[model samples]
Target: MANVSRQPICTLEPKMQNTIVIGVIIRSQNSKIIELARDRFNAGTRAVWNFTLRDSFNDFINATVWGTVEYVNKLFTTFTIGSVVEVINAKVTERKINDPNEVYVPSVTSPFTLTLNQHSSLIQMHNSPNTARYLKFLNMPTKDPGGATNLNHILNNSETLKNEYVDVLVAVTFVSQTREIVTRMGEMTKIREFEVGDDTTDQTVSLTLWESEWIRLADKWEPKQTILFLADVQVVFNEKAKKSILTIVRKTIITENPMLKETEELRFQFQRKPDIRSTSLYAVPNPNSITKQMMIIEITSRLNNASVLPSNDRMQLLVVVRAMVDDMNLDCDDPTLISYRCAKCKRLVSDEKESCMNLECPFGSGIKSPINITSINVLVNLKDDTGYLVGCRLRDAAAEEAFSCSADIMRSEFKIVSSTYTT
Candidate 1:
C-alpha cells in the first residue's frame, strides 16, 4: 500500500506556550514514558497514563499513543515502564485536582501520528496472532440472563433508526423525582421534563414528555431509579416559541430497554458529581463600579392557583420565568416581589441602593413600549483560564472594552468574576 501522510494534527505545547504539529519530532532526554498498568496485559492498553516531562511547569498529563496496537508489539520487546521516547503527536492537558502541585497532563486518548514512519512495522505488529487474541478477549460480547441483547443493536439494524426523521435515541439517564410506575402503556406519571445536555442544546432541540407520559412516570417510577428510556420522538420547528420543541407521540415507548436495563442494575450510574470549584458563577456587575452585585433572599411563599391570572397573561409570564432565575410567587393576590437591581436603577441610585430594587425602571420592568434600547439579559460565553481568548457577552460593555484592548491590558483592567465574595 502507498504511504499516505495524514493531515497534521496540532497540539498545545507542554508549557502551554505554542501549538506544534502532531508529527513534529522533538529531541528531549528529560521526557520519559512510563507504562503504569496493573498487569503486563494492561500495559499499552487504552487508558490514561500520567507522567511528567522536563521544561513544563505542570508535570502531569495523560499520554495516549494512537498507533499503540502495532507500535507496542514491534518496539523493544520489554521497554522499561518509564522509558524516555520522543513522542510524535502527543497532546498536553491540564491536570484537574485540588492539589496545586499537580501538573497539566496530556490525554492518552488523543490521536497521534507516530514519529517512526515505518508502515510495515505497524502492519506486521498488528497482524500478529497474539494481538488478535488479546483484542478478542477484550471485546468479548456479553449476554443478559434473560437472553435480551442491546436494543441499540436492533435499532441499528433497522432502517427506521437510520431515517432522517429518527434523530439519535438520546438515552437520558437521570434520577427519577417521584414514585412512579413503568406501565405497559409506556407512560410516566408526574415525571419531570427530560433535558438534553442539561435542558438546552446549541442545536435548539429539546425533549418534552406528554401529560400521560409524565403521569405514568411519576406514579410508577421510584426516586433514583435509572434505566428509563424515552424513544421515537419528533422534532418540531416551533418558530413562534423561539425554540425547537421535541415531541414524543403516544406511540413513543418508555421502556426498560437494554441501555436503561444496564443502568438500572448500576444504581449510582445516574448520579453526577459536578466540579463546584471550577464551575462558572452567574453574576451581574454594579454599574457604578466594576464590582458584582449580590442578593440573598429566601422564599416566603409559593402559589399554584392557575385561575388567579388570565390564561393569556399566565402564558406570557411563563416565557420569561426561568426556573433558576425567577422567584416563587406568593399565594396573595398582590404578590411580594423578590427584588434585584434593574440596570437603570443600579446606574442611577449608586448611593441609595447597592443594587437595583426599583420595579419601575425600564430595564427592570418587563414591559416594552417604544424604547429602541436592546433588552438587558445575562449572556454566557465559553472560555478557558489564563484570561486569553475569553468569550465576551455582546451586551456587556465592560467585556467589549476589555476585548478591544490587548491581552495584557485586558487582564489588568477587567477583574475576573469570582463567587467567593460579592459587592
Candidate 2:
C-alpha cells in the first residue's frame, strides 16, 4: 500500500491573490477580444485568444477559453462583439505590438471571469479550507454566484451604508466660491481641505488633502482662480442633503494633482503678458496712497492711456472707456478717441466730429443745425470701477479727446528705460 500525506495548497501572494470568484456574473464586461487557431506540428492544435476589459473608470485584462476546438467552434459560432463569457486561469500578459517574442506575463493574475463555472471555482477556492469559510458557512452566496447582485445592492444602498471606500462626485463651476483651510490631525501633523460649492442644491463638499500634497498646493495657489480637479479628489456625500434633497454624504480627498503644474504654469504665463491698460491706469490714485484694489481693472485694454493727465487731474478724471475705443492723442496728456454713428446720415464717425461728412445728408449744410453741429463733449468724470459703458451714444469730439489723451498718457507712462549711453 502506498502511504500518502496531505499536501498544503499553494497560496497566492497577497498582490496576486484573486479575490474574484469564478462563475460570478460581472455586472459589466468590457474588453477587446481576438481569437485565433494554432497549427501544432506534432501536438494537437490549440486555440489562442486575447481580451481587454474596459469600463468608464478602468480597463483590465480578461482571458477567454472554450476548452477545446469543438467547444470553441460551438460557443463562438454566433459570438458577437459584446457577447459575455466567464473566464478562468486568466493571466495578465503583455504582448508587444511589434514583436511576438517580447511577450511577457505580469507578476499578478486574476482567476475571476464572467463564466459561471470559473466563478464557482473561485468562490470555492476562497471559502474551502480557508479562514473565509466562515463567510461561506454564513450561507452568504459565494462571490461567483452573486457578486454582481451584491455589488448592485451595495451601490443602490450606498447612501444609507456610508461606504467610505467608494464615492461619486460632480464638479462645481464657480471655483472662486470654494474655500481651503488646513487642520491639525495629530501632534506635529496637519491636513488640507478644499471646500467646494453646490449652490444648485445649496450645499458644499470638502476635499481632504494628505501630507506632501500641502507642499505642492502651497507652492502655487491664489485666492480666487477657477480650476478643475479632474477626478483628483473624492466626494463625501452629505446625509443632510439626503434628508432634505436626497443627496449623498461624502468628502473630497486629493488623490492626484495632475493639474497643479499646468495650472501654475498657466497663471505665470498670464501674469507675464504685461497688462498694458492696467499698468497705464496705475497712476490714477496717489501712488503713495493707492491701495492694491484701486490700481487693478477687470478689463485688459484700460491700461493703454494711463499717463496723459497730470497727477492731480489723473486722480480726478474718471474715464470709463469701452473696449472698442482707441486713444489717438499726439501728446501724452489727451483723452481717448471714441467712435460713434452720425445721427443725421448714419455714417461711422469719430467722436471729434459733430456733423456727418456724407454729402447725401439733407442737414449737413447748417452749423449747429443738428446736421452741421459740432461734436458733443460730455465731461467723462468717471469712477475707477463703478462705471460701465453699455448703451451710451458716442460723439466725434469724445473720440478725438480719447485718442489724444490716450496717446499722450501712453508716451509719458511707458518711456523705455535706456540702458545705452550715446557716444
Candidate 3:
C-alpha cells in the first residue's frame, strides 16, 4: 500500500484527478448487465454497479462502476458492506440534479457522483485504524427519523400523499418469501414483500423489494427486531385496492437499525405493548374498531393483494369470523404439540435445543444460558360458505383460551385421550 494523497468526500470536485479517496461502503446494489445496441443486428453487454460511501466526518456520496460484465461484477462482488474502500483516479462528475433519470438514483448529500471505470480507476479494500469510525456510520440514518411522516398521518391522508415522496422510520413486521414473475416484456424478475409498522399507527404498510440486492439483504431482517429508516419512498395510489401504498423506488435509500434517540423510543414503545397482530400497537384493539367482518374469500382476496400477510404479527386484521372449525388436532398425541421459543429474540427453538441459535440474540452465544418459553402450537382449518382457511396458527394465549387449558395441562390430557381412543 503506497502512500497516496487522499481527499475526504466533502471536498471532492468535478474533473479532479490523481487524488485518492477512502470511505466505507454504506450501501450497494447488485450488478446488472445492460444490453447495448451497436447496430441493427449487433449488440453488446455492459455491467454497472452502484454504491454509496460515507466518510468519517459523515459526508456521503454515491459511486458507480461501469465496464465489461466481468470487470464490474467482480468489483461489486469483492467488496463487502461496511468495508473501507480506497478509490484511485476515479472521475468526479457533476450530478444532473434536474434530469429525469435522477429520480432513479439514491438520495445523497453530495453534489457530485464518482464514476469508476475499468480502464483508469481502481477500487480496493483499505485497512486503516479509523475503520471503526467509518463502520459506526453504518448505523447512522441518512435522514432524521423524527422528521419522517407519522404512520397514522400517512394512513389517514393517503390520498393526499399519493405519488409523493416521503421519509419513514418503521420496524419490520414480516418478510415474505421471494417470488419470480414475468414482466410484460417476458423478462423474469424477483420481488419480496415486507410489512412495516411504527409507534404512531396500528396499521402496517407494505414495502416491496424489487432489486435482487435488496431481496438478498432482506434475508437477515427479523420481524419486530429490525428497524429501517427509508428515505424518498414514493406513495402511490392503488386504484384497485382503493388505498395509497408506500413503494421503494430506486430513489429510496434505507438505513438499518439506526442509532438515534427516536430509535430507542420506538423500541421502548414496542416493548411496553403486548405482542399482538397488526391491528394495533401499544394497546389491544377496541372491539368496536374490528367490525369489518369478511368471508373467507374476501379475506383471502385481501391477503393476496400483494400488500401483506393475513397473520402478520406487527399489524393484524382483527375480524369476527362466523365459520366452523373444519379440522383440529387438540387431542392428538404429537411431540410437536408444544412450541419452544427464545424469550429474548422470539425465534423458534427446537425441542432438543437449549437456546436460540440466532447469533443476533443476546443469549445466542453459548456463554449465556438462553431463556426459552413453552406454548401450545397447533394448526386448525376453518370453512365457510365462501371458502376454507387452512393452516391458521392457534398458539400462545389464544390457544390456551380456545382449549380452556394451559399448554402443559393440554399435553397431559392429550396423551390420556389418545390412549383411551386407541384402546
Model 2 ranges with Cα > 4 A deviation: 1-161, 164-186, 198-200, 214-423
lDDT of 3 by residue, 320-380 (tens): 7889999986647666778877665557888525877878666675536666667899878
Residue-level lDDT of model 1, residues 297-378, one tens digit each, is: 1111112344577665431110111123122222122211112222332333322224333455443333322111112122
Ranking under lDDT, best-scoring first? 3, 2, 1
Q: How many pairs of residues collide in each model?
A: 29, 57, 6
- For lDDT, the strongest prediction is 3
| Model 3 poorest 10 in a row by lDDT | 279-288
User: Model 2 reaches what TM-score against the true structure?
Assistant: 0.21
